[model samples]
Structure formats: structure tokens, C-alpha cells
Target: MTTTTTTSDHADDPHLIGPFAIVPKQDCTHLADHDYTLPASAKRVDGHQPPCTDCDAIRENWVCLEQNCSQVGCSRYQQKHMLAHHQNTGHNICLSLSDHSVYCYGCESYIDSPKLVQLNRQLVEASN
Candidate 1:
């Protein structure tokens, strides 16, 4: 029996987060018929998911200017403009795009991807 998997198949799968999924990479063709199960340890934990630590720090240090918004905005709506307004008011919950690290003055949550870091820098600068 042959089974084919695609990104869409894992779109709603709890084990799938961000861009990674169980589908075979374009270069690999041998495992097309098998269902791959990610290890339990790889599954994300409830509430223990990755934290935007920088955002948390920012909230701790600064108060939001928008009456209805927090550092990341409301649970129902998140707007960058609102977040920028908060930052402009001295909330420092910005993350480094180059590495997905949060900059909390001298304290940082380092996310090692250079591309993400660069992207984050661009976003912060643009917002400013």
C-alpha cells in the first residue's frame, strides 16, 4: 500500500508546528508509503509552548498605551501598529528577527536562526 503525504495533510495535526511536518522532503522518495509518527517528546506541551520571552519582559517593564491592547495585543486581535505604539511608549517586547531572540535590555532569549534575526531587525526598525 502506498500513502502520500503533503503539507496540507499535517496542517491541522497537533504535531505540526510552523513549517515542519511529517511529509517527505522533495528529495526523498522511499518512505512514501509509511505513516510517520513524531516522538511524544516532540509534541508541544499545553501552555508550555515557546514563549515570546521578550514580549513578556516588555509587558513587565512598560504599560500599554492602547487602552485595549497589551504588548502583543488582545487575544482576539493583534495589530503591529498597536504593538509599535506600545513599544514607542517604552515597552520593549520586541524580538530579534535574525534569531527569534527577545531583547530585554541585556537579557535575551536567543533564537539561533540568522535569517529570522535579520527579519526581526527589519520589522523593529520599520515599526520605529
Candidate 2:
């Protein structure tokens, strides 16, 4: 399993507190109709820490939440490939493969969803 460490730069942001980013709200317009379901084609091709599609860094990777897109990319703190994916495809939501934390680039914040958490839990369990 991959581990996440909080950096000093994130200390100033109240919403990014703790070992992980804080979920300010539970509602996200982009996920308002989302079912938090992974596509049938989705699989951990590279185990828990998949290499970013745009780069070799895998420590801070994330998977796109868009149903048809299973693209993985390093986090903004690394290569920003996931952000680039969002910019290029307008697919704003992603789940951190490191911690299964849901984030919406459109909302620019962490999002809370029990269903999503459960789904990620299942994914993790299956992988083990």
C-alpha cells in the first residue's frame, strides 16, 4: 500500500489539514449525478502504485473518476499530470490511489461520499 505524508506548504490551508486533505463539504456539482462506480475495464495494472500515464512517478498517483477514463497520474505536488488530465479532458474528479480520497478539480477541494469510500474500500480489499 502507498502512504501519504503531509507537507509544510499544506499547513497554511485549513482545508488541507491532517494526514490528508479535509473534506469541506459532502456535495459536489460534478458528482451530483455520479454513482461512484468503477468501470469494468478498470484494474490495477501496476499494483497499488501505478505509474502516471504522463510520467514515471507513482508515489502520489491518482485515478480519474470519469467512467470511461481509467487514466492514472501523479499528484499536483509531483508532476501535476492529474491536473493536466483534468485540464485537457475537463474530467474534474479523481480519487487518490494513495488513500482513496475523492477530490474534485472543478470544486478545488476534497469531497466526502460514503458510497465512494465504500467502493474504494472494496477495491482495496480486492487488490489485497
Candidate 3:
């Protein structure tokens, strides 16, 4: 894992409210279509499941914007993004990219990785 945090574009946006920032109005459940299902070659090498067994957010192969690190897993991408937020926001704590958990173990209820976009949409919808 890259411990080298960037003060670059990955830094906190003054616009966001919490550690878990939403992309605003982007639908989480239905991301832009990718034609067919993800091929076996597209799977994460990390052994952790992608698309989230819980939310079913990623059903296709959407590559990460970051070159060479093109992870297609919605949960993995979200977790990595949130991990950066958690690191920068003074909420520094145990975060596992492998486990993709923001909270401590034995806890019930979690903010679903894919639902963050839906939450953003709701906020957008509510404000309008």
C-alpha cells in the first residue's frame, strides 16, 4: 500500500461535508454502462471481491482514471478514495484496503460503498 499521501488533487475539498464525500448527483446504482460483464482478466489481483457482495454497484468493467492502477471494483475504488479522506481529515485510524472496511470489526451497519452516489443524488434531489 502506498503510504505516500499526496497534498495534490486528492486533498479534501472545502465543498465536501464528511470523510465520505460523494461525487454529487452521479447515480451510484447505475453507473454508465460498460457493455458486457467484467472479464476474468479484469478482476482485482488482491483476492478481495469486487462490486461489493452487498450493494452490487459495479456490474461492468469501468477502469480507474489512474493509469496502471486501473481497478474496476467500485468498492475498492471507493474505499481507496475514502481512505485518503480518512487519512487527511484527522480521522486517522485503522483502514484496510484489503478488507475495505472503514469501521472497526463487529459493528453492524455500514455506509454502503455504492450507496454513496445514491446519497449524493438524494442530497442533490433534496436541495433542488
Candidate 4:
């Protein structure tokens, strides 16, 4: 995905030097038959934000969206725990906890589809 960086409003914050927005792919083949809701067997976290299962990071976290797997992990920019999860389990897709963005590791891009939009909305509501 192509990313464009611009200055952030919070100039005083070192981590907020700029905002990074990823230009997502229009669709993903893997999500063609995805069930938009979390599986019944999926365990829900108690709070709105949960830490990564592998590293306990609260920021830039992602939840695996393969089958009944809901494993949370730190983003690639942090510890790459999600990448490691994909490598070990072959679970391709994940949803970002911070922004509700959907990503497909197999496709190597963020996905932006009608179904994904619905799914992201469902997740946001579920989290709340």
C-alpha cells in the first residue's frame, strides 16, 4: 500500500510528527465469503482496548481475523508480532484495534470493501 505522510496537529509530540495514511486496495478475494461478525467461539476482551497477546502493547495492535482466531498482537512497526503470527499460523487477515482498518497479509495490502466497511463498523460497535 502507498502511504503519504503529512505533519500532525500535535507538533509537540515526538511520536505525532506526522500522520501516516495507507492507501488501501479496493477489495480482497479472501474476504469474499467472510462472515462479518466475530465467531461465537471467539473470546471477547473485557475492555474497549486490549493489549497484544504476545507483547502486551496497547498501541498499534491488530487482531487476527482468520477462522475463529482472534489473537491480538503488536503491529509490524512495533515488534512485528502480527507478522510472526501470520508466518506461524498462515492467518492472513487482521483488523487494527486503533483505527478499525482491515489488512490482508496474503494480499500484502489494506482492504477497503463494502463488506469490510460493514465488518469494521460491526467491530467498532462490538468493542463499544
The lDDT leader among the candidates is 2
Candidate 3, residue 116: Cα displacement in angstroms equals 13
Off by over 4 Å in 3: 1-15, 27-36, 46-128
- Cα lDDT tens digits, model 3, 1-128, are 66754435555554344545533322223222332222332344444334532344443223232212323333334544433433344232222224332231122123234433443343345336
User: What lDDT is reached at residue 14 by model 1?
Assistant: 45
**Better-scoring candidate (TM-score), 3 or 4:** 4
Q: Residue 88 error for model 1, in Å? A: 5.5
Q: By summed lDDT, which 10 consecutive residues of candidate 4 come out lowest?
A: 9-18
TM for every model, in the order presented, reads: 0.18, 0.72, 0.19, 0.69
Candidates sorted by TM-score, descending order? 2, 4, 3, 1
Tens digits of per-residue lDDT for model 4 on 1-128? 99754465545543232365456777578775756654332334565457788888777888887766878888999999989999999888888877777889988888777766557667667767
Q: How close is candidate 2 to the true structure, as a TM-score?
A: 0.72
Q: Ranking under lDDT, best-scoring first?
A: 2, 4, 3, 1
Top TM-score prediction, candidate number:
2
Model 1 CA deviation exceeding 4 Å by range: 1-70, 73-78, 85-88, 96-99, 103-128
The alpha-carbon lDDT assigned to residue 112 of candidate 4 equals 74
| Model 3 clashes, total count | 0
In angstroms, give how far residue 109 of model 4 lies from its true place: 0.8
TM-score of candidate 3 relative to the true fold: 0.19
